[model samples]
Structures are given as C-alpha cells and as structure tokens.
Target: MEVNLIVETLKFLVLGMSTVFMFLALMVVVLELQAKIIMKYFPPPKENSLVSNSTQELFQKGNFSVVAAIAASIRSYKKKSK
Candidate 1:
C-alpha cells in the first residue's frame, strides 16, 4: 500500500507539471502568432525626417530656455541622488 501511494503521487505530479508546461507553451505560441498577424495587417508608422528636421531647426533657432530647463531638472535630480 505504501509503495502504491508513492507511485500514484509521482504520477499525479508528473501529469500536473506536464499539463502546466503545455498550457504555458501554448500561450506563448498563441501570443507570438497574434503579434505576427497584427504586424502583417497593421504595420508600425515610419519615422519622418521632416518632423525631426523641424524640431532641430527650432532648437537651433534660439531655444535655450527649453535646454536650460532640462539641465536644471537633471542637476536637481543628481543632487537629490547624492
């Protein structure tokens, strides 16, 4: 009886573990398939150089206030960390 109980317990453990592993593997496969399908149907937008160029032009045309604010914020963050 003792031997039989241990054998049954090990069988149950293997079956439970295998079921969980299979479920997780299936979930990963399904998610990958969904991502591929979405990408195929609805692709991401391309980056526009014109937009970036305009932003650079604005910075080049005397936008030191924004730059100064960013530097001040970074300096304050560094001081807080120290």
Candidate 2:
C-alpha cells in the first residue's frame, strides 16, 4: 500500500540521519580528546622577548618591497584583462 511505503521511507530517512549525526558527534569528541592528549605530552614553545622585539622592529622599518610587488602585479593583471 502507498501508506505503508511512505511510513517505511520515513523510518529509513530517520535512521540514516540519526546514524550520520551520531558519527559526526563521535568524531568531534575523539578529535578534542586527541588534541588535549597531544598538548599535554608536547606543549607549544614559549615566544622569546628578543624574537618578538626583532619582529616589531622589522614592521617599524617600513618593508615596502612586498607592497610594491603586489601593486605591480595587480596593475599588470588589470592591463592584461583589458
């Protein structure tokens, strides 16, 4: 009967969706646990003050070569498109 078919289809849809949802939930939990374990065993290195100061100094000294290159590329691309 059509009614029986509809009910069966609905049941199948619910089962499939539930299985997918449960799988994703389990994956998230496992990944979080793995990250915690790795962090505990081998933690990230602390940043040194000397390295931080040097990075700041580099920024303070305007580094314009990178900016110039990007602008040149954009200009070349615009010319090519036209």
Q: In the order shown, what is each candidate's alpha-carbon RMSD?
A: 11.4, 12.6
* lDDT of candidate 2 over 1-82, digit per residue (tens): 3579888899999999999999999999999999999899988776533443343455565646655665688899999999
Minimal lDDT window, size 10, model 1: 48-57
> Tens-digit lDDT track for model 1 on 7-81?
889999999999999999999999999999989999877654344434355568676776677679889999999
Which is the leading candidate under lDDT? 1
Provide backbone clash counts, one per model: 0, 0
Ten-residue region with minimum lDDT total, candidate 2: 47-56
lDDT of 1: 0.81
What is the Cα-based TM-score of model 2? 0.53
- Clash pairs, candidate 1, are none
lDDT of each: 0.81, 0.77
TM-scores of the candidates in the order shown: 0.51, 0.53
